[model samples]
Target chain A: MIGTWTLFQRESRRFLRVKMQTIVAPALTAILYLIVFRYAMGDRQVPGLDVDYFSFLIPGLMMMAMLQNAFANTSSSMIVGKIMNVHVFLLMSPISAAEAVFAFLAAAVLRALVVGSVLLLVLLPFSDLSLAHIWMILFYGVCGSLIMGSLGLIGGMWSKTFDDMAMVNNFIIMPLTFLSGVFYSVSQLPPFWQAINAWNPFFYLIDGFRHGFIATGDSDPLQAMGAVAILTILAVLSAWYLWRIGWKLKE
Target chain B: MNALEINNLYKVYGNGNVALQDVSLLVPEGSFFALLGPNGAGKSTLINILADTVNASSGSVSLLGHDLFHERAWCKRRMGVVPQEIAFDPFFSPREVLKFSRGMYGQKADDAWVDELLERLELTQHAHKITRQLSGGMRRRLLVAQALVHRPKLVILDEPTAGVDVELRKRLWDFMRELNAAGTTILLTTHYLEEAEELCDQVAIIDQGKLITSRPMKELIREVASSSLCLRYAEPLQLSDEDKSILSAFSPRVYDNQLCLTLNKQDSRSDFDTVYQAAKQRFGTPVDVSIRQEDLEDVFLRLTGDSS
Candidate 1:
């Protein structure tokens, strides 16, 4: 447990030491997203929902920040350590693979929470959001971050270079998050696209998180939570399996 | 008890490249041992396997009486490794690095011990500076300090002085000697034969992924029973066909204006005396004469078959 905490502290310090890039830059980007989408389509309302577009956008943006920051935290740390050969320090230590994996996940989730909280605070004045079901909010926030953090660990272990990590982020993570109803609801999309969104785990994450804020969702909150839980488990298991096999880690 | 023991260790990579081949070794407790080998002879591979960085295809390794694979956590806690490459997070300072390294071993941070290590490695001045800002030698020293953070019972240093300066190398060896004297087992691999000859009590030579010889340093040196006699003439000696025939049997050749004759252990003083007489009879007189005894370099070359 001490070993895990120490590694957690080290991973946290690594990102916090470069706040301008890790925290400040992402916070600014989230704020910018909020600003651009609000000005472009603030007064509009969804067909059945009564809330303003800006209010609806708030939860999506917050979830987006949480997801992306979580992924970036773990993926960037792993890739940088791999490239620099610094992972050897951890590998040669007495820390078990499970401890190392959990430490990284904990650090990533911590960063995601910080980024999400900051974004929420920054956009609070621009829109009205009800935190009626705080339990759901906390659940989705943590579950969403855990899922993304696990994916980040998988991508980090599979990638051999920074370029490969960028490929995973740009092609896989970015596209999925963008199309997961961040700026608009899935109901506004065509039936075929909505069908596709149903298959994307990110859709459940954003939908569940928004349901936490507004008590409104396109799908059953229970079903969304179930899907997110399953996906998180799969991602975590994949990362653990990779670590156990020493894939691309031990030679 | 042996500090380390390996039984029939073998490492075959996925590409079918055999890195280690049935190699076995033992280092008694409190012994400073040297593992010497030419490039591609599996020295680093053996160290990596012991460090748990690389999994051996087939082998059993015991460190300090604990099975390396079965009781890896225990073995790892009792061993420290300084790999051949410089590996550290550039974002971390030396102080933070050591603290984190100690923490990884489930050890509490001891500021006094960390500071002492920094001072001993001459890295105190750079303790707070980011590792990337440190000089190459300073970075190397920091690596040494990082490996010692947990104060393991057995330390494996793989070419630790490869790029370090002379003064730093001296200090590093001095610290290593002190640690060995204090009962810490030290296993080192170095290209510098003189360094090995000076510091290591026992030496093992490996060639082509096989152990060629393992013995005490003095014994290994003495086992190579070949010497050379070097003669320098006042001027270039013009030799007749008869003198050439006599010197040819001894493989005498002019090197840097000196005639060098290779002599085996069986060759007596009279054999050298005969060569001296022939040289004097042919060249009028010799200006200088010296006998060179076989050293570690000779033994290493002969064992590795790198000698011409």
Candidate 2:
């Protein structure tokens, strides 16, 4: 337990030491999205939803920031450690593979929550959004971060270099987050696109998160919750399995 | 009890490279043991397996009687590894590195002990400096300090002095000798045969993934029964036919006015007297003469056949 906590603390300090890149940059990116999209859309109402476009977009943008930063936190750390050969420090220690997985997950989740809170606080005065259900907001924020963090761990473990990590972020993570209805509701898209969005796990994360703020979303709340739960479980289990097998970590 | 023991250890990589081939050895408690081998001879592979950085394909390892695979955590808590390559979080200070390492081993941070290590390694002034900014020798010292932070009973140093300067290497050996005197079992893998001969009590040599020899340092040195005699003359003297015939039997060679003769260890004294008499009668007494006995280098070269 002490080893796990020490690893978590060290990993957290690693990112927090570079707040400009890990926290502030993502927060600034979120705010920029809010300003640019709000002005372009001009107070229009989201189709089939009572809230205005900006209000609905706020939750999506916040969740997106959380998810992206969470993923970046773990993936960047892992890739850098691998490149620098610093992973030997952890490998030579008494920490178990399971403990190492948990430490990385905890650090990623912490960074995500920190970025999410900063984005929310920075955008609160500008937007007329209210937390309709605080518990739902907490649930979606944590579960959504967990999903991305776990993906980041898997990607980090599998990648051999910075370029490989970037490929995963650009091709896989970026496409999923953008097409998951962050800028526009899935209901506004064609039936074929909506069907595709229904299968994306990011869609549930965004829909569930937006449901927390506006009390309404494009998907069924219960089904979205189930999807989030299942994806989170699968992601966690896969990361743990990879860690235990020492894939790309040990020789 | 032995500090370390291995049985039929084998490591076959994914590409089918056999790094360790049924290697086994034992290091007695409180011994300064040396693992000497040529490059690609599986020295690093064996060290990595013990450090838990690499897994073995088949076999077993035990550290102080604890199974390395099954009781890994327990064994790890009692061992420290200083790897060949310098590995540290660049952003972290030396103090933080030590603190974090102590914590990783489930040991509470002891500022006094850490300070003592820093002082002993001559790193007190650079304790708070970012590791990336430290000089190479400083970084190497920090690596040593990090390994000793948890006070492990057994310490493994893999090429600890590979790139260090003479002064720093001497200091490191001094520190290591002190630690060994305090009862820490030290396991070292080095390419420097002189270092092993100077410091280690037990020596093991591996070649082509096989343990070629494992014995006490003196005993191993004694196995090679050859010595050399080097005689330097004050002036260059042309060898007479009689001198040539007398020296040719011992394979004597002349370089820079010095005649070198290789002799069997048992006949070295008599051979020296014979060579001295012949040289004196021919050259009217040389300027200086010295006898060089067979050291670890001769034994190592003979066993591994790696003269280069």
Candidate 3:
């Protein structure tokens, strides 16, 4: 357990060391999403709601930052390990697969939290978003981060090249996050797109996170929790399986 | 009990490349065993198997009498591995690296020992610098220092001095010899046959994933030390074609200023003097003759020839 925590601590130190890349960059990207959504639809109001566009987009932006950074943390770390061949240092020790998985997942969650915190801080002055349920906000934020981070671990383990990793990020993760109601609500979409959004896991994460900022949309908090929980469980299991198989790790 | 034992180890890659085949060797307690092989000769694979970084398809590896696959943590605690690759996170200082390695091995942090390792490896000056900031040679020494942080009973170094300079290489061999003297069994895999010849008590040569030979250094070298004598004369020697042909039967060669001969068991000291006297009398100038013993490279070439 101490070994696991030490690994986590080492990763956290690395996170702090590269704050410009890990923290500032994601927060900057989130701020860009805010500016674009605010400018394009500032005066526009939803069909049955009075919320401003910036206010509505804040939670989604936070969730996006949380998810992307979480994924980036694990994937980038592992890819760097591969490129530098520094992974032998970790493997030559007595650290187990379980410990490695937890440490990486924990680091991913921490990176997500840092970026999410920065996003929330930067948006507080510009938007009228309120904190309705802080617990829901915290739970979904961490859960979403874990899910993405674990997926990143799986991607990193599966990737033999940087291009392979970019494919997962650009094609799979980007498309899912974009179509999961980041810029718009699923209710406004047609039936086909609505069903696709319903199946998208990011939809629940953003919907749950939005519940914390506003009094809500997209789904019930109970359903949101269940969705994110299932996705997190599945992602964790896959990451653990990859580690067990020593996918690209032992070879 | 042997400090390390490998029995019929085997590894076959998915593509059917046999990285190791029935490879077996033992490092007795407090022995400095050298595993010598050329590139792609399964040396790294053997080291990886013992380090538990790579799995074997068959046979077994035991460290300190504990099964490597079953008692991984227990065996790992007693073993240290300095892998061939110079690997270190650029984010960490040498001190942090040592601390982390020690902690990972389930050993309590001992600043004194860590300091000693740093001092011994001459990494104290750069102990606080991130790995990326250090010079290449310093990084190599840190690899050695990192492996020693846990005070493991067995230290396995896989080409630790491959890129290092002569001074650092000698320093490592001296440090390793001291460690062996202190009861830590050392296993080294290297391409430097001369280094192995000088440093290792027991040597094993592997070829094409198989253990070609394993024997004590002195015994192996002595068994293969076919002596050679080279004669250098002050004046050119003229001989008939038939006489030159007769000299060629002794495996003799004339080049530059010398005549070389393959010293055989049948050639006695009197025979050497007679040949020298005859060459001097024929050339009308005294001939200088010398004999030298064969080294490990000769033995390695003879045993594992240039097949692959």
Number of residue pairs clashing in candidate 1, backbone atoms closer than 3 angstroms, sequence gap of 3 or more or interchain: 0
Greater DockQ among 2 and 3 belongs to 2
Ranking 1 against 3 by TM-score, winner: 1
Residues B64-154 of candidate 1: C-alpha lDDT, one tens digit per residue: 7889999988999889899899887988999999999999999998999999999999999889999999988888888888889999999
- Cα lDDT tens digits for candidate 2, A57-165: 8889888888998898888888888887888878889998789888988998899889888888888898899898888888888888887888898898899989999
Task: For candidate 3, write residues A1-251 as lDDT tens digits.
Answer: 76787788887888888889889988888888778777888677654445666778888888988898899988978877877777776777778888888999999998888888888888899867799999999999999989998999889888878989999999999988878887887788999888877778788888888878887777887776876788789989889888876888886
Q: What shift in Å separates residue A64 of candidate 3 from its native position after superposition?
A: 0.4
Per-model B-chain TM-score: 0.84, 0.81, 0.82
Candidate 3 runs further than 4 Å off? A48-50, B229-291
For model 3, which pairs clash? none
True contacts kept of each: 0.84, 0.75, 0.58
- Model 2 lDDT, residue B271, Cα: 62
Model 2 docking category: medium
**lDDT string, candidate 3, B183-242, tens digits:** 999989888888888888998999899999888988998877776566777755444576
Q: Order of all candidates by TM-score, from best down to worst?
A: 1, 2, 3
TM-score of model 1 relative to the true fold? Answer: 0.92
Q: What are the iRMS values of all candidates?
A: 0.8, 1.0, 1.4
lDDT of 2 by residue, B123-149 (tens): 899999998898888888888998899
